[model samples]
Structures are given as C-alpha cells and as structure tokens.
Target chain A: MLRRLIARWQGIVLALIGIVATVWLALTDQLSLYIHPGTSWFAIVMALIGAVLVIAAFALTPLEDDHQVASDASQPGPAVHLHEHDPTAPRSVGSGTIRAALAAAIIVGASLALLVLPPATLTSAAAAQRSINSETSTLDQDATALVGGDTSSFTVKDWAVLLGQSPDADFFAGRSIDLVGFVSSSPDDPDNVFYVTRFVVTHCAIDAQPVGVPVYLPGWAERFEPDQWVTASGAIVPNPGSSSAEPLLLTPDEISVTDQPEQPYVY
Target chain B: MSPPPAPLRPAPPKPSTRPRAAVGLSLGVALVLLFVAIRVLAPEAVGDVLSNSVQDFFTLSISVVIESLPFVFLGILLSIGVQVWLPDGFLLRHLPRNRVARRVTVSLLGVLLPVCECGNVPLARGLILRGLTVGESMTFLLAAPILNPVTIITTYQAFGWSDGILVSRILGGFVIANLIGWIYSRHPSPMSLLTPKFQASCAHAHDEVRASRTRRSVAMFDKETSAMLPALFVGSAVAGLIQVAVSRDVLVTLGQNPVLSVFALMALAFVVAICSNVDAFFILAFGSTFMPGAIVAFLVFGPMIDVKMLALMRTTFTAKTLVQLTVIVGLASAALGLAVNALA
Candidate 1:
C-alpha cells in the first residue's frame, strides 16, 4: 500500500512541476520573446487544457499496480538479471538518489546563472551597436533635412521605426541621418554602388524584412564587402534625372568599418 | 414433462449498459469546478505579468502557424497519399533487408519528406506499419524534421553561405540521425518496450479498409485526420506556451558556457518547441553569441523531443522506452554539437 501511494505521489509531483513551469513562464512575459505573436494565446489555452487533463489523469487513475509491474518488467534486461544474483541490488538505490540530487543541483545552478549574468553583457553589447548606428544615422538625417526642406515625416518611434522610414522620405527635405548596416547589392544600381540594409522586424527575426537606402560615394565599394558591418554618414540627395524612378537617394560623405556587433542581426 | 425440464434452466444475466451522455455530463461538471478553483486562487501579481505575455503568445503562435501552414498542408496530403495510393508492403519492399542499410535508407527518406516535427510521428508510424525496422523507423522519426526543405531555406537565410552553416546543418543532421540509429541497433533491448499495438493497428486498419470496397477513400482520410488533428493542436499549443514563457535572454544566458550551454540550449529547444520548419529563423535571431554548432543542435534535437513529441511518444512507446530514447537522443545531439563546434 505504501509503495502504491509513493508511486501515485510521484506522478502527481511530476504533473505539478509541469504546471508550475508553464504558469511561471506565462507570468514572466518571456514567452513572447521566442514565438510569433499570433498564436501565443491559443497556445496558452491549449497548454492549460492539456495540463489539466494530465493532472486529472494522474489523480483519478488507480493504475499504480499496473505501472509498477510495467516498470519492473521494462528494466534493462542485463541490469535485472544481474540484480537477481546479488542481495545488495537494492543498495544501488542510494547511488540513484545521489545522481538525482546532483542533477537537481546542476539545474538550479544553471538557472541562477542564466537569470542574473549573461543578459547584462549581451544587452550592453546590443545597446552599444544601436548607439553607433543611431549616431551615424542622425548625421545623415540632418544632411537630408538641409538638402530637402522640412523634417515632419521622420519622427523616431524606436530604432526600428527610424531605420525603415528614413529611406522613403523626399531627399533634401528628408532627415539627414547616419545609417549603420551590412552591405548588400543595390537593387537599382549595379556599378560599384550598394544599399545599407537592415532588417525591419515585426515580431521576432523570423518576420524580419530587409530595408535599405541607396549609398553612393567614391571608393565606398572598396571599403565594404557584402555582409561586412559598416556605418555610413551622408546627406540624402535626389538622384539626377531619376526623381520618379528612385524613391530616396543618399551620397555618403564619410564611412568607417566597425567591428561586427554582438547582435549582428538587427531585427 | 419435456417443456418443464427446458424451463428449469436459468436465464443468463443481462449486461449492464450506461448512457454515454451521463459520463460526459459528469466530466463537464468536474472541469468547471476545477476551472473555478484555479481562477479564484490565481494571484493578482501574476495577472499583470500574464497580460503582455498572453498577447505576445497569441502573436507568435499565429505567426508560426501561418508560416508553417503550407508545409502542414503538403504533409497532410502526403500522409493521405500514404494512406490511399501506396499499396501495402510497398515501404517494406523498398526498405533494406540489412539492418544498417535499412537505417541509412530510412534516414535519407526522412530528409526527402518535407514534414515538420509534429507530422513526423504519424509518418514514422505509417512507415513502421509498412514493415520498416524499429531502428530505421526511429531514424526517420528523428531525421525528417531536421532535414526538411523549409529548414534548409531558413538556414541559408540565417547563416548565409559564408560560414557554411547550412551545409553543416544538413551533414550534421544526417550523421547524428545515423549515429542514433547505429547506437539503438547495437542496443536493441531499449526499444523492446514499444508495444505491439503500434505495429498491429496499421495492418489492422488497412485490412478493415480493404474489406470494405464500397467505402470512399475520403472516409479513411477524414478518420485519420480527425484523430491526428487534436493531438497536433495540443502539441502546437504546448510549443507556443514554451516560446512565450521562456525569454530569449534566458536561453542566451544559458548558452554562455560551452558544455552547460549546449545542454541548456537543448533543453530550451525542447521547451520552446518551435516547429522545425520555422525554427531556423528563431535560432538565427539568437544573435552571434549562439555558436553555429549550438544552433545546429537546437535545430536537430528540438523536433525529436519536446512537450508535444512527449505526448505522442506516450501513445506508441512505454514510459521506459521513451526515457531511454530521450537520453540517447539528447546525448547524441550534444556530442554531435561539440564535434561541429570543434571542427568549425
């Protein structure tokens, strides 16, 4: 009877652990950081239902006897056979207990390390990258503002908003901003010209879309390779005789190669 | 006198029959009570935290489901084809008689079929029923999600050609799948806990359908879809919850140390449980801190084991088999990850 009770309690304990983990994750707001925004609610609802079912199944079932027999039968054949010859077989449980304790300690230690340490360094690195991009883009936006006319269309909502919207503004009236991104081939021009491209992220990087503005400057092609990280400072200018063809254009005044930021992918 | 003798025999007891409606009503009542208790006792502090999380959860879940919708549709159609057009014993005939060859072939086939992790379970079961060996079936089960077309495209987009992340993922997946198969073949006893029911049902279902020539093929498709869809939804939900609840920062933080980082990322893979089709994008988003090798492990290991996979594993294998397989897959994945990192 005691063994049966123990077995039943173990099942319940597993279920409880699962439930607590799920609820804790939900309460932490970390869930959205990993998945798409559209399905998270349905996922939570279904998880709740599944957890309830699992817990109920454990609590209601009087199948401990069957479970024990199955477990015993399923024990690795060599181990069981060896156990049959040794009266000291039951003593092995102490070793199993020790192993379990060790595993628990490791799990706890890791969780603490994750919660407190790495985020600080990673966030700082990401912030440093963002600051560099912002500074360069601010210069370009100022240049564009001088060339075009006014700066009503280029309000910064966030880093992402600023990056995606700047390329569409009318040259000379557009914000003179510094832009930092990886070099990709310019879609409009092929000859020694490129676009400074960054990802426009809607949710996670999965839905990230590429956004860029044309960059034309002397010797710009020689300095930056495709996928090389760079920050370009330039004024937004209208392409000669291509007002209707090109949306917005930039002539870079200065450019510098920077170290690949920790968070290489902006989105 | 003869009639009296006949009447002397006692009548047999009637079998008791209970209405299904009664059972359902009681179940409904119990569920309602449980929900009430949870709602009443739920903490207010947690409520604020959950609001944004709930929103984020819905968003992510919808996006992933939408992205994988095409693959899911194609996979279901393929499953239907396996059910209807493929003749019985077709897979068995194609499968190699030699154990090692069979394992390799099945793993290759797993790469060919472009299904996500959730879809692999049914496909593996289907193949097993068609006479694939246990090791081969398991190989297919592990390899298919990792090697699919969608994953390949996403990996290319993520790491690009410069680092050779895409090629590494494919080759690494193939090697790991085979290694797992080889290990399991050498130690075949761990798999003995898989019940005969897994083998019995497919043949049984096929026989029943064969006997009924008048039944439309659509009927079988519908039946299988209906049975599998609920499990699929449940699995998707579990994956979604994990994604929402666990922070990316948390996962990245865990990836700091070399060995523990690999295990941590693998566990995160199991928890976040993103579909293999779209997981490449997520892994790529993890930033440059995540090693190419660790990302590969996450991609390879996640589809084979996760919350939803666990639920499915329960249906076919005993608890013991599931535990053994989980340990073996986890260890193999970690070792492969270390190897790739070292080579890089």
Candidate 2:
C-alpha cells in the first residue's frame, strides 16, 4: 500500500515543486524581471493548471490500477533519453528506473536553483559584456523601427539610432530630452561620464538588449551611483573631445533619483 | 507502460512489493528540511557570491520555461484534442497521400501552427501518431517554427524590412525544410527510426484511452505535462547556464572573421535557443558587428535546431538520427550563409 501511494504521488510532488517555484516568483513580483509584462499572465495560468494537474493526480491514484501508476512513476527514463515512438522498434534495454531518477533530479535542481537565488535585473557588468552602444547622438534611421514620432518622445534607442540619420553634429544642439533608466557606466570611466541604460526586449528577458546613452552631469557627477534609477532632463550637445565622432552628448539640467518603474524594462 | 520507454502512455505494471513510498516520502521531507535550513541560514552569503551572474542565469532559465510552456500547453491541447476528440480516420482521410502533393501541402501547412521549435516536438509526435508519413511530418516539424506568421513578420520587422532578409529567410527556410524531408523520404525505414515503445503503445490503449470527454483531456494534460516538463527544465537550465558563462560580446569578436563567423554565430544560435518568433530581435543586435551571411545562418539554423530542440528530440528520436539532423541542418545553413556572405 505504501508503495502504491509513492508511485502515484511522485508526479504530483514534482508538479507541486513547479508550482512552488512560480509562486515564489510571483510573491516577490520578480516575474517582470524575467519576462515581458504582456506574457506574465501565462505564467500565472500555467501555475494554476499545474496545480490542477497535481490535484487530479491525487484524485486519480485511488481509482487507477496500482500497477499502472507504478509503471508511469517509473517510466521517466526512455521518455527523455530515447523516446521509442514506434511499436515495431525494439524494446528499450536501459533501465527505466535510472531514467526516472534523472528526470526527478533535473527538475528538482532547476527549481531549487531559481527559488534560492535573489531576483535581479542585469548588472552593469553584463551591460558591459553585452557592450551596448554608449554614444546615441547620431543613429542610422534606416536601421531601427523609429519608436517615437517626434523629438519629444525620444528614447535612449531613438537617440542611438539618430547617429547616422542626422545631417550633421549640430542637428541635436538644442534638443531637450527627458528619459529614465538605471545609471550604469563603463569599467574605467571617471565620475563625470556615466550611462543611462534601458533594456529593450523584443520577446522575453532572454533576448533583452541593452540600449544606453552617455550622460555628462558635470558639477553633480560625484553624487550619483551605478545601477541607480534616475530621471534626466537635458539638452543634447556634441561631445567636446570627440567632436568628429557620432555619439551625442547629454548635458543634464536637472537630475533626480526615482523609484524603479513598475515596468522597468522596455518592451 | 508496454514495459518501459513509455513517456506518455501509462499502462499497468506487474507490480512491485518494495516500499517505494518510503523512499519518496523520505526524500521529499529531507529536501524540504535541507532547503529551509540552507535558504534561511545562508541566503545572504549565497546572495553575495551568486547574485549577479547567477541570478541573471536563473532568470534566463526560468524565463525560457515561462515563455515556452504556454506554447507547449497549447500545442499539447491541440494535438491531443485531435487525437481524443476526432473520430478515428478523420485525419488520415482528409490529409493528402500523393507523394509530391502531400509533402508540399504539409510543408506549407506549417503556416498555421504558431508554436516555435521548443514546443513543436509534442505536436509532431501527435501528427505521426495520427498516420502522417515521416516525410510529411518532418517537413511540418521543421518548417512550422519558421514559416509561421509570427516568425515571418518579426523577422521582417527586425531587419527593418530591408536587405531582402525577409524574403531570403522565407525562401531559404522553405527550401531547407523541404529538402531535408525529401532526402529523408528516400532512404527511410520509418519504423526502425522510431523507439519501440512508441510503436507498441501506438497500437494499445493507454490511460486516457477510455475516459469521458473532460476526463480524457485532463488526463492527457496530466500525462503530457509529466512527460515533457522535465525535458523543458533540463533544456532551459542548460541553455541558461551556457548563456551566462559565454558573453554575447565574446561572440561579437568572431564576427570580424567572415568564414569563422558563420560557424560561430551558428553555434551561438544553437546555444541561445531563443524562439524563432523573437530571435530576429536578438540577432539584430549583431547587425553592426556580424556579416549578413552569419546573421542569416543564425536565424535559419537556430529555429530548426538548438539546445532545446536537441533535448526535446531525445524524447522521440535515436542519437544517430539526431546527429544526422544536426549535420544536415548545419551544412545547409552554412551553405546558405556562405552564399549570402559571398553575395554581400
């Protein structure tokens, strides 16, 4: 009887672990950091469905033939390693027992890893590893989708795309821009020059690409911190040293720290 | 089921008297206690050491599962719906069987299935079970992920609809999937290619074979969930780990070398395993750095084969078959990518 109960509930226990991991993500409001806002509902729905499946398994075990559930409980092997779909194919020689244990181990390891870790957005180090374009003054208009219709709605990406499209460096001289992103900087940059970066995601966090622009807060540069969320209101100007380069320079008039936005990553 | 190798089919065993329950219960209890103790006592130390890259890795891994599971669910729902709800013979009767006509029709039929590469495995398994020939089904499996509306429009948009990438992707992907299907159709011992369990279970009634409508579907949902979820996590964890350890910037340096770049980007594509519908956005970041051919290869090779596809494919195919699929896909994408590189 004890053997019958274990075989039947093992799948449910695994499913329960999946549910727990998702719930942990949800409770911490960290799902947003992992996926786009539009698709977060699916995770919730999957959690609910996963719960239903676990519950159904619990109910079905008593009615099911004990031999039947035990077979399934033990069959996670070939299903993963060599799914013998053809009836005419030869019988599996490997132990189903071993495969089942492997499946259990993988699922448990993955779930625990996520549940135990702290939730975080990509770091400045990764932003560097991604090597996002820092100079956004001049951009290739033809290359990007052109998100904003006019100068007032310009994002960090729009400014980056403006590099090649501009007739010349003077084109952005007096353009006033307002933008919000987490503060980031190059590894060796001084206090005055730091980047304001936002991740642009086409699908999910896995594909999010960082788009950032260099901001020069001359007098107040030393007061800021990396990865600090802030709003910068500034006028665009060409960089003094690299006048011939296309990267636009931002000279901020007012800068203030802000709470991380509800939808922190751009879609 | 059928004495092992049954991922989905749950049939009666002869029964064992060993107390498997005690092992399971003890393990569960131990796992909970250990996790609680470690998480409560040592979280800060773990966080200080593992928070940055490790956290990103965890996020990437979980997000991959989060993104793909919905499509997997929908695919399973649709595939099993056809199996359980459709009166027998309905599918085989409606689907074309003329060699050329059937392959072409089914190949083009992929436009309707929106699921990407990771989620298409279960659906393809269903199609085969419904009597579609290996050739026809393989064509659909390969083409469906790329030819669908979501992938097409996204690719177009990602390229900013310039440089003929949209047309080239369509033309190139269409040709590759069809050719592979055509080639496989020539030598094919379809039965031997498949695992024996699937072949046997295909004839027999498994657990959900007789339940009522709701029960049947729910049972199927339970069965497929058990079968596929473990593989999804395994694949995602592998993919996430690779992404964290290898930086995208490192891959960017190889883009300067044209010949090596294609292979580099191809390997990157296989490792990243981003969905075809959204890979264009990811690859677009490489636009300024990588050549056109490398870009095309990344797009074309990735959707057809990747870490997720490899992990998922093992559930149904032999190692030999997977190797063949990989070599054929790699060579074809390389040829296409090089052709585009030469043109550029």
Candidate 3:
C-alpha cells in the first residue's frame, strides 16, 4: 500500500501545482487577454470544478502495495512482473528526468515570451478606421451632388463610414455608394433585389461574419449567380419603414462581375 | 519431517517492514511544498511575470475547459454508458464481416460520434479494449473529430452552401479515413505496439466488472477516470500555453513560403494544439494567404497530431509506433489537401 502511494505521489503533487497555478493566475487577472472577455466568470467556475476533480482523483488512488499485489496477481507473465516495485526503474528515471526538464523549460520559455512580446498590433484596424474617416468626409462634401450633380469628392470609405456611423444618417438615405460582394438570394423578396455579401474577418477568416448591404438593381437578377462575387456602383435610398431587415437600401447605377479579392474576409 | 535439520537460511522480511504508503504520502507532500516554496520565492522581476502568467493560465484554462465542458461531459458519459450498457457482442454482431464492408461501416459510424480530438483518444482506447480491430479503431480515431455533427454544422454555417466546401470537407474526411484504415489493415504491425501490460490491465478491469453482478462497474469507471484525467489536464495546459505564447504572424510569414507553408502549418497544428471542435474557424481565417490545400492539411493533420494527442499516444503505443503514426498522418493529410486543391 505504501509503495503504491509513493509511486502515485509525484503525479498528485504535479496535479496540485498545476491546479493552484491555474487558479492563482486567473484570480490575479493574468488570463483575461487570452479568453473571451465576456466569459471570464464562467472560466473561473470551470477551473474550480476541474481542479476539484483532479485533486479528488489524486486523493482517491489506492496505496502502492495493494496496487502492486493486484497487478501481480492479474498478470502472471515474467514480462509484467519485472521490477514491479522499482518506481524509479531506468526507463522511468530517464524519461521522467527529461520530461520534467522539458516541461520546466517550456513553461519558463512561454512565460518569458509572453512577458516580452507586445500584444498583436491590429494593422487592419488602423487602416479600416482611416478609410472610414476619409470616406465620411468625402460624403459630407458630396451632399449637394445628390441632385443629379456629378461629384468626385465622395469616396467609398466615406460613404461606408457615414452609413456605419448612423444607419439613419439623413444624406445617404437617398444617395448611392459603390459596393462589392457575393450575391445571396433572399427567400422573402423574390423581386430583382439581392444581398451583396462580404465577410468581415477580424483575426482570421475562421471568425469571419457575413455582412451584406441590400441592393435593388434592375438587371441584377440576370447578371449574377448566388455565389458570384460582383461590384456595383449604386445610389443609396431609405426604405420606408418596411421590414426589420435593414432600414436603408441601394439602387445600383452600374453592376459588374469581379474576381474575388485576395483576403476577401476582414475581421 | 520434524526430525530434519533446520537450514541456516535467512527468511525474507514481511511486507510490513516497508513503510511504503507513509513514504509515498510524505514525498507527495514534500514535492507540493517544494513547488509552492519555489513559486513563492520567485525573484521580484520574475514574480511579476509568474503572477501574470498564472493569471493568463487561469483565464485560458477556465475559458477552454468551460467552452469544452458540455462536449467533454457528454463524451465521457456516453463512453461510460457504452462500456456498461452496450453488450459485449454488440460490435462483432453489428459490424460487417467483410473487410471492405467493415471499413465503410466504421468510417460512417465515426461521423456520428461528436467527440473532440482529445476526447477521441479515450473513446478510441475504450473501443479497442472492447474488441474492435485496429483498423476499425484507427478509422474511428481519425474520422470522429472531422466528421462529427458539431464540425459539420459549424462548417455549413461558416461557408454556407455557396461553394462545395462543406461537402468537400465531408467527402474528403471520409475518403481519407477509410484509405488510411485500409492501408493500416494491410500492414498490421502497428497493432503490436499496444503494450501487453496495458492490455492486460484493461482486460483485468473489464473482467472484474463482468464477474460482479452488482454495480461494481462504478469503481472501475472511477479508477480509469482518475488515471486518465491528470494527464488530460497537464497536456491541455501545455497546449494552452503554446497557443498564447506563439505569434500567428510567424506562422503566416512562414506559410507564405511555398512547400514550407504546408510543413509549417502541420508543425503549427502540432504545437498550437487547438481543440478540433473550433480549429476549422481558425483555419478559415487563414484562407488565401496560405494555399487552400495547405489549410486543409492543417485542419486534417492538426486534430490528430497535436502535443496533447502525442502525450496520450505515448501511453498506448511504443515510441517507434508513435513516430511512424505521426509521419503517416502528416503525409496522408498533406496529400489529401493537395488533391482537394487540384480537383476543386
């Protein structure tokens, strides 16, 4: 019994250290950046449960003598019986020493890396912000161009920025901006209207979410398939208190089929 | 007999002479104390680092464990129930007799079990002990994470039905699993890697329960769970650390360089060791930058070959076998990815 207990002692100690370290780190707020901000509380709870399970398992394991006898009785072969009581057999000693050293090295290395490395700089975030700001400014200058006047002042980014800033922004409620995305058919609206969809990816394409602006182009139905990526220059118009889908709609001036851009999704 | 002269032999000491349990308990306590002391006495500069690290560790641990709790619990319960309730002859009776038919059936069945890659290890182990052939067990291990309902639903939702990515992932996973299983069956030497001692232990546990008419199976379940859970926690902790510490920029940069990208992602998959349940999301995010084929390779190869899986694999197979399996899975996944890219 004693021998069996000793054999499992190392595992038990390691597990406890792991549990304590995890809990301590979480409670001290170090774990916040990696996990979803919203899920921090839940994470703590689960950690506690996991820790308890681990500790309980460690405590419940049978003593070494009983374990050894049980094992010996179960397997009669010499192969199974060799050095049964030697917990520090050469194979175990070498492997254990190496594994422990490697684990310590990894933990230390990771800690140093995390400490030295800065948080990922959001390169796209800055660009997106700049583009939106620029577009918004242009749209403001082109406010008068909506009355059948030609305006080169407004840029695509400004219009997007304006639309995003106020889905109810008054000027764009009846004006148009150029947009590009894949065609997605709406089941309810069987007219020539389709959603021009693009994915906005943040970190990677994996977390990409679909964003679509509704468009009503006269010949759009015949021009594009559901998955075909296309670009359309259009006029923005407000929907008259219709469905909850989207308040504003687009009226395309010209539609053209386009190839999917590299990095099609943005987070 | 009493008249015979007594030999001058020394009798072996009784088992009571060894203070085994006490020594073990003290050693365990001493190690814990030693670690705690070292943690407490960390240098001031490193103290801040350790504190931050601990916090990060806790947070990541919690998030991952909670995120996976539902699936983990369900998988364990199902596994336990399968062990206790499923008849001994269930697989043998239901599984097809022909090799080809068995392969197909096993592959199809693998899709229905919604276990993450880590969870699949235990399930695979259980299936093997329950008398499933190596080929069937291998097929299940490879296909379970890829073909499960959760992965399918997630994929459908991610890509929609616009292109055939969803169908392609399924078809690709199915074909690859079966092909690997068939090849494995042809050369069954890998099956010998399962240590006889481990098999005997598993069999003994099973036999004990079978011998008892009462609810003694709970004890066996507890024993197995206890044995497996510590390794699981440690392995996962290591994986989490790698995920946080490694930069994606490095991976992306490496991924830009031709064939190196494929090997890089495969290596990254082994290192980052994300759960199979949500790895596809990460893979999709890296689209276009890395070859679609390479990304597919990452997805297929990663779940089966991560650090945690390797650790678990060590428990079952010899070192030689583990290395061979790793190479085989790596090559197979890459080939499949290339094939898909060419055909698509």
Give the top-scoring candidate (lDDT).
2
* lDDT ranking from best candidate downward: 2, 3, 1
| lDDT tens digits by residue: candidate 3, B1-344 | 00111112222323522443344335445544655555555454542334444444433443343344334434444555556567777867888999888878877665667677766766666777677766677788778888888777866655566335667667777777787778778774645656443544554535444223223333333444433444555565676566556655577677765566777788778876666766766565455467656666777788778787776656555566678778888888777666656665
lDDT score for residue A101 of model 3 = 57
Residues B84-140, candidate 2: write the lDDT tens digits: 788877877877777777777777766877777766887777777777766667788
DockQ of candidate 1, scored on C-alphas against the true complex (2 decimals) = 0.04
Residue B242 deviation, candidate 3, in Å? 4.3
**For candidate 1, what is the DockQ-based docking class?**
incorrect
lDDT of 3 by residue, A199-241 (tens): 4432222222344566765446677766577887777777643
lDDT for every model?
Answer: 0.51, 0.67, 0.53
**Ten consecutive residues with minimal summed lDDT in candidate 2 chain B?**
B1-10
The local lDDT score (0 to 100) that residue B52 gets in candidate 1 is: 39
Candidate number of the best TM-score: 2
lDDT of 1 by residue, A55-142 (tens): 3333232211232222222223212443344343332545445534533443333222222111111111222222222223322223
